[model samples]
Target: MGAVTMGCGDSCPLVRAKVREEWNIPDPKDLPDDDFRKIRDLIEQKVTSLLAQPTG
Candidate 1:
C-alpha cells in the first residue's frame, strides 16, 4: 500500500465511530495542512523503515 491515503471529509458516522473506537486516530483531514503534511511524512518514514527492516 502507498504511504498516504486521502479521503473526503468524515461523513460516515459508522466509519468514524469505528475508527475512533478501534484505532484512536484523529481524522487527519480535519487537521491543518502542516499537521496533515507531518502525518504524511511520518507515514512515508514508517513505510520506508518497514521496507528496510530485515525479513525472513
Candidate 2:
C-alpha cells in the first residue's frame, strides 16, 4: 500500500514506510481565507503531480 501524508508532525508513524510522500505543509487551521486557499492550491498541485506518475 501507498501513503501520502500532509503536515504530518515530527512523530508521524508512517514516515518509515518505503512508499510514502511527505508534504510537510504547515497547518492551515485558523488562517485567513486567502492563505488557506494558497495552501489548498499547493496540495492540489502535489496531488496532480502524483497522479501523473506511472505506477508499477
Candidate 3:
C-alpha cells in the first residue's frame, strides 16, 4: 500500500494509519541519467526487501 502524501505533518489528511517504511528519496525528474538510475536502483532494492518479508 503505497500512498503519496504532500507532507507527514499532523494535519495532513493523506497520512495513513499503517505505514511500513518512510523513504526520503529525492525527486529524480530533473536529475541526470546516472542520478536517476541510482534512485531507480535504490527503489528496486527497497521494494525487493519489502516483498521478501512475511506478511501478517
Candidate 4:
C-alpha cells in the first residue's frame, strides 16, 4: 500500500503504509485562480516526477 499526503498535517490519519510520501503543498482552498493553478501545476509536476521513477 502507498500513501501520499498533501499538507494536511495532524488533521489526516494514515496508517501502516508500505510507501508513504508527504508533499508540503499549501492549501489551495479559497485561493485566487492564478494561485490555485500554480499549486495545481506544481502538484502535477510532482506526480509526473513520481510516476517516472522506476518501481521495485
Candidate 5:
C-alpha cells in the first residue's frame, strides 16, 4: 500500500489526526545546495499557505 494509505507505525496508530498529508518531496540530502534551496522554498510556501487557512 502507498504511504498515504498505510499507517506510520505501531506508536502512531493510537492517535488520530484531523488532517494527514503527504508532500512526496524528494530528499535533498546529497543534492547540490541550489537544488536543496529550491525544495526548501517549496516546503516553506506550502506551509505558509496551509497556515493561511481558516481553522474552525
Candidate 6:
C-alpha cells in the first residue's frame, strides 16, 4: 500500500484525501538486492511491532 505523487501538494489525490504515506526515505524502489533486503527488513519490523499492539 503506497502512493506515488508528482511532487506537489493540494493537487495530489493523496493530499486531498488526507492519506498519509509511510516514511521510506532514500527511494529504495530500484535499489540493489542488498538494499531491497534492508528495506524489506525494516518494513517487516514495523509490521511486527504494529501487530503486537493491543487493540480495543
Descending-lDDT candidate ranking: 4, 2, 3, 5, 6, 1
Score every model by TM-score: 0.51, 0.77, 0.68, 0.81, 0.69, 0.53
lDDT of 2 by residue, 1-56 (tens): 56787765454574465577779887888889999999999989999998999888
Model 1 lDDT tens row, 9-54: 4444444232221222356688999999887786677667767967
Better of 1 and 2 by TM-score: 2
- For candidate 2, the TM-score is 0.77
**Residue 48 CA displacement from its true place in model 4, Å:** 0.4
- For residues 1-56, could you state the per-residue lDDT of candidate 4 as single tens digits? 66788876653454766788889999988899999999999999999999998887
Worst 10 residues of 6 by lDDT: 1-10
The reply for model 6, stretches above 4 Å from the true place, is 1-22
Worst 10 residues of 3 by lDDT: 3-12
lDDT for model 1 comes to: 0.53
Clash counts per candidate, in order, are 0, 0, 0, 0, 0, 0
Alpha-carbon RMSD, each predicted model = 8.2, 2.5, 3.4, 2.1, 6.2, 5.4
Give Cα-based local distance difference scores for all models.
Answer: 0.53, 0.80, 0.67, 0.85, 0.65, 0.59
lDDT of 5 by residue, 1-56 (tens): 11122323233454576665567677778889999999889888877887797876
lDDT for 21 in candidate 5 is: 58
Q: After superposition, how far is residue 24 of candidate 5 from its true place, in Å?
A: 1.3
The count of residue-pair clashes in candidate 4 stands at 0
- Which ten contiguous residues of candidate 1 have the minimum total lDDT? 16-25
TM-score leader:
4
- Model 2: number of backbone collisions: 0
Candidate no. 4 TM-score: 0.81
User: In candidate 4, residue 56 scores what lDDT?
Assistant: 75
